[model samples]
Target: MDPRDWLARNTFHHSAFQDLRRLVAEKERQGLRLSLCIPTLNEEKTIGKEIMLLRAELVSRYPLFDEIAVIDSGSSDRTREVAAAFGADVYESADILPETGTRRGKGENLWKAIYQLAGDIIVYLDADIKNIRPHFAYGLVGPLIERPEVRYVKAFYDRPLAGAGGTRPSGGGRVTEILIRPLFSLFFPDLAALIQPLSGEYAVRRETLERLSFPIGYGVETAHLMDVYRAHGLEAFAQTDLDRRVHRNQSTGDLGRMAFGILQTFLSRLRPGGGAEALPELHAMLRQFQARDNAYELVEHHIVEEERPPMIDLPAYRQRRGLPP
Candidate 1:
């Protein structure tokens, strides 16, 4: 299908899913359980507020999700403590499955949540959003419950960069505009319709997520959009506009490292079968530069874009999900 056609059919606004009670009733009638996962790394300041709102509004009031969980990547603050206090089931990354080992990244937390969470459909929310609302969860869930064929629902937001004084109402998707969007325009045009391609808010069916390879780093979200598009085509995806998202901004240097990881994942998917005919192993370390007074200093960031195998391939996961072994 043409990219414009896909955008017209797939693009949606949060207001369209305004009836939370109706959405909840449909979810129950279909007998589909929902789970919410918040991946964290030292996000004490905002994790508390996010869980409080989600639990209070979605779980207690409306009963949209069966479980609200926090998969932490070794937080150094009160992120886990506060979330637990606010009634979120918090689990450390290492404790999920000790035998398989663990890695440190947002994607790792997400990948493990699949095994740990109990819902047939999973909704992932970023832990650092300062202006998080209930819509971030219910909006993404609405499309899946309303439309049976929609396997994945992504969130697009007016990402406002927060400053000391206040927020500016624009400028959050730097890497998406520069790297991911252009890459999509060149390679996967249909996926270019995704407004916030790398937005960390989305709800995905468990079957879709379990079948795709997960890049356990900055490249995870980008990899998911392309992977899902490859598996199910444009029809499998839908996006809902969440209006505004307020969050802290990263430096240009940090974004460069992220782009490097994303580029590695993007390139690996070029040729059929992970480009095995031409591509070799991708290097884990990412090299960058910094200026000290007058001289330029080289900095090496070990950005290992290690991927987790599909959850369906794991025996433990199958047992947890009660699938045939």
Candidate 2:
């Protein structure tokens, strides 16, 4: 399909799905179940409002999300407490699949959510959004509930870099502009059409998610788009315009770390039929320099990009979901 045609047909604005009642009716008619998963890590400052707003609007008021859950990465702060207080079913990442062991990253929580949450359709969101609104949830979910051809809905928006007093209208997603987009333009031209390929907000069907692997790091979102597009093609994917998204800011150094992790994920997909295993396992240690007293010191930061297998292949998960062996 032509990029322009795909953008015109698959891309949508939030207003198109503003009628909550009609969307709910379509969901019920299809006998679909919905789950909202917020992957968190030390987000006490904003977790509470994120949960309260989404729960009140999507879960209680509209009945769009049957359950709202927070899958955390063992936060030292009050993130879990605040989320639980706001009526969210909070689970520590370590506790979800104890037998399989655990790794820490936003992707870990997202991967485990497939097992922990009961929704047939899982909508994953980041926990640190200062401007938490219904559109973030509904916009992603609307496309799937309305169009059967659409298996995944990703959120794209005018990302305003948030700060203490206000926000810069543009300038966030340093890693995407610097690394992922240019890379995509070269290899995966069709995927470059995605406004925010690394956006954390998306809703995916159980069948679509169960077949893909999850990278437990910055690479997960990018990997998902590449993997899903490979298996299902452009026809199965859709993107929504959420107007604007305001989230916490990260420094260039932090973005460098993120870019490193995402690079490994992207390279793994490049190998002919490689898809991660096709390339040698990437190293977790990222070496950077710290300057002090006009002297440079080498600092090796361990940033492992561990991946979880497709949920459908696990016996325990299959049994829990009552699927045949």
Top candidate, metric TM-score: 1
How do the residues 1-325 of candidate 1 rate in per-residue lDDT, one tens digit apiece? Answer: 7778878887788888879889988999999999999999999999999999999999999999999999999988889999999999999999998898988899999999999998989999999899999999998988899988999999988643344666454423889889998988888888888878888999999999899888998889988988898889999999988988889999999899989999988887785764445777778787888899999999999776889999899999999888999
Name the best candidate (by lDDT): 1
lDDT of 2 by residue, 1-325 (tens): 8888998999998878989999998989999999999998899999999999988988788998899999989999999999999999999999997888988788888888999988889999888788889989899999999889899999988643344666454422778787888988887889888888888899999999988899999899989988998998888889988878788788877888898899888887787665444566668788888899989999887776789999899888999999998
Q: What's the lDDT for candidate 1?
A: 0.89
TM-score of candidate 2 versus the correct structure, residues matched by position = 0.92
Candidate 1: minimum summed lDDT over ten consecutive residues — where?
163-172
Q: What pairs collide in candidate 2?
A: none
RMSD of each candidate relative to the true structure:
4.0, 4.1
Model 2 poorest 10 in a row by lDDT: 163-172
